[model samples]
Target: METGKRVPVKAALKSHCWIDANDYQSLYQQSLQDSVGFWRSQAQRIDWLREPQKIRDTRFHPDDVHIRWFYDGELNASSNCIDRHLAGNGDAVA
Candidate 1:
């Protein structure tokens, strides 16, 4: 099996601007050094029913590398997007 290719949407009206290459390179290096803390901070921004036990797991050879999320638990992405938002009394746009 092969990874799916993403289409290059150069002309699309993007909601966000691209990060500066130099800035991203530095940030990427820092993130690799402390991925758990970085990811934990990001996860805090979200309202999770059950917080993650393990922030990250990078135990694999590069050739057969695989990242496993919620290795100690589970999460429902669809429910979070739909149910949680509505539960918060947030308005929905048709």
Candidate 2:
């Protein structure tokens, strides 16, 4: 009931087709329940030069602080954003 708080609610139909409320809730739940699997699935959407075998690296001690995600994954942002879209949406404005 408070502002800036996240709460799951039923899906609602809207003009936008990218994502809906229910889909977002489902993704949020999956992210919490299986973080590694959730992130792996999301990573599949990108073009990785070297696919990552590990999803997370949280091996840290009280004195050491280090965290990483998709470790060792290599990807080109220009290729993913521009090259990949050249076939269908090259002329389309971003």
On lDDT, the candidate that comes out on top is: 2
**Where is model 2 more than 4 Å wrong at Cα?**
1-13
Candidate 1 Cα errors over 4 Å, as ranges? 1-33, 62-64, 87-91
Top candidate when judged by TM-score against the true structure = 2
Among residues 3 or more apart in sequence or in different chains, the pairs in candidate 1 whose N, CA or C atoms overlap within 3 Å are none
Q: How much RMSD separates candidate 1 from the native structure? A: 6.3
lDDT of 2 by residue, 1-94 (tens): 7899997543563554577878999999999999999999999999999998888998679898789999889889999988988999868888
lDDT for model 1, on a 0 to 1 scale?
A: 0.69
Using all chains and alpha carbons, the TM-scores for the candidates as numbered come to: 0.49, 0.77
TM-score result, candidate 2: 0.77
